[model samples]
Target: MMYPPPESQSLKTLLPETPILLMGSGPVPVPQEVATASSIVISHLGETMKKIVARVQLMAQYVFQTKTTKIFGISGPSSAGMEMAIGSLLWPGRKVLVLNLGTFSARFAEMARGVGAEVKEILPQGLAPIYIEQVREAFEKDSFDVLTIVQGETSCGVKNIHLKEIVELAKSHGVLTIVDAVCTLSTMPLPMDEWGIDIVFVGGQKGLSAVPGISLIAISENTFQFISNRTQAMPHWCLDPRRAFKFWGLGEYHYTAPVTGILALHEGLRLICEEGLEARFERHLKCSSALQNSLEAMGFSLFTPAEFRLNSVVAINNLSNVNTKELISLLIKECHVEISGAFGLDIIRVGQMGEQSRFENIERVIRALAFGYGKFGHKLDLESGLKVLNISRDSGKK
Candidate 1:
């Protein structure tokens, strides 16, 4: 039988509209001026807008250090970035080795196989991550043309330590390393060229705090030459990076890059530079730590192990006598705070990304959540948790 919505409308009515806190998906608050700048770029670059494309590619280098790259504005959401990367690189007869620790990794494995590449998955169940030892063993067992891994597993709130080492491993084996930093880039430290990452893809919607439409793919000089040497046909028209590179190099749109999204992404990257990546990383780490400390004191167990936990995000277990789905709805409908459901079951994640990583916002989320949980019939030790949240928030302010 389908479960009924918990908590009466009576409870929801007493709460505020549009939850005062947002701890869900990235796309954190954008500065008024930055938001306006993106809109202005879109309107001003009407019709002949290759300049927008050039600006995006150049700005990406400034922010991400993804030198000599191609930007594609294919028809798909953030997830499409992976498909574009995989479909473009993997040939029909190629073999792919994927080190998957979460849902996105699984999707990558599936997509690679669908493209007719032989795929193998190395995933760790429960709350742990795939360590470097496991990856080394996998590499020894099988040879692969390309090695792919997600930088941050958004599904489980874990960051695999194997990202840098694994990429280096691929380099040693004469295999290409493709990193899915769709959720990690800008939020954390990912130096593409320095780290020898051949192909790196990230979405604008996450830590960049821009609307979802654009995906940034970086191609290294070595990988560019490697792909060009391949005899396989480009699987898709819009995703072909060779075509994109020519257009970007000549400052023209081979296939129109997302004009408006390019604008939004430019502003977003601008803001990141303004804030400084090192400072931003510290803020995200601080915010996630504060949230985790507060939740743990309130008796919420973390689904991911403490050491390997992602600094930009955290996943918490469902409290006793609480339905995760119903609790999430109440958080939105009543408290006006939004969080995401767990990767597997009864879990809720708190995201600290971009402007949402601010101390004030984190405090509001902790306070409102403390109050909100009471309405759900869970006796969350409100005073203790809020006290911890405030302490960390104040510490961060200083």
Candidate 2:
């Protein structure tokens, strides 16, 4: 008989008086299944922990759609996974080519440079998409061993749709590919094996809707062999993928694993499987589209262009008349909604990911935003935004 998950109070139950709407980049509301898993008590070095580790490994395989690649669950957030990928693949004398689309890609390049690797960046101007011709030109001018990129840059709400082409280009030139899919793992279409990505990592909290602290890294066989054959020792133990796989995969017990985090991720992936990958992707897209249409109707312009915009996160420009900080404070204080702050320019980021990606949630955010704008003496066209939402709903029905 299969045992059921433990019962626990949810975030809503704990905070009954104040209900918060989380539309930030990560740590979204968790589903009941994930919360239940997190509430369970399991030993760090026991049969239950072993089963949990195996379940997570299997879930990673399913989520990434890979059969032969090695998967490891690091006991940290997605940044740890990024470090592991870089440390495993890049060393001294190695050259890395990074496509700097946003803050995350810039971080990847910084990490590469910190590791004594020669780094060249293809920084796109503003929020524009990096064209293939630019990448071709860069590749022709410089010879690099690894190409690092982010599939979806959460900071600027940009998705590189031409990731497969970029990876194929790198592979053709004998260059390894490293992808950071922290924001687009389950919400977008990413076939690691089919697209020929060498190393990729994702966060458990962002798209998977699990608690933060688990980073799943999937390594291709060729990349695994390359890391295994490296003569130089990795600077840190956590940055070594072989050590992570040995401890997490083989149950050798490197350090204390995050049992609750692993179990929560397992349940989160199970829920994703139940929802069906294509269905989840469609839900995210529809919700994002509705949010964008509503925001545009309310006289707010999106930061990223339509072609390069991400379905998981939407960034909007701040009104010239209203103070951004004051607007954000009013939204949280009065409307009980929480969103991310501004980045380079005055832009607000809203995430529609995992359990938060629903029609009711999207509508709630729009209404709160409209109400907040009203408090600042600026009247927004809420009716027009609602009409757009209704139209989107009707179109979906048809």
* Range of the 10 consecutive residues with the lowest summed lDDT in candidate 1: 40-49
> Against the true structure, candidate 1 has what lDDT?
0.75
Model 2 Cα shift for residue 206 (angstroms) = 1.0
**Global Cα RMSD, each model:** 6.0, 5.9
Over the stretch 1-398, how does candidate 1's per-residue lDDT look in tens digits?
99988866686787674535557756556656557755753433344456666666677775566676555444456667788779877978898988887788888898898889999888775567777787788889988888888888887888887678888878898888888887777878999888888888887777887667677788787777877787788887777777766565565546655666667777888778788888878877887788888888886788878878886667777677777777778777766777788766677777877767877777667766676677777777767777887888678353
Top-scoring candidate (TM-score)? 2
Q: Candidate 2 residues 1-398, lDDT tens each?
A: 99988897687766737767787777788988999999986887877788777887887887897874488888898999999999888889999999998788899899998899999999886677576777899989989999998998888888887888989999999999999999899888998999999988998888999988888899998888888898998967966878877777688877777788888989999999888889989888888899899999988899888998988889898776777778877887787877777666688888988977988888888898889878887788999999998788678584
Q: Quick one: how many clashes does candidate 1 have? A: 1
TM-score of 1: 0.89
| Clash pairs for candidate 2 | none
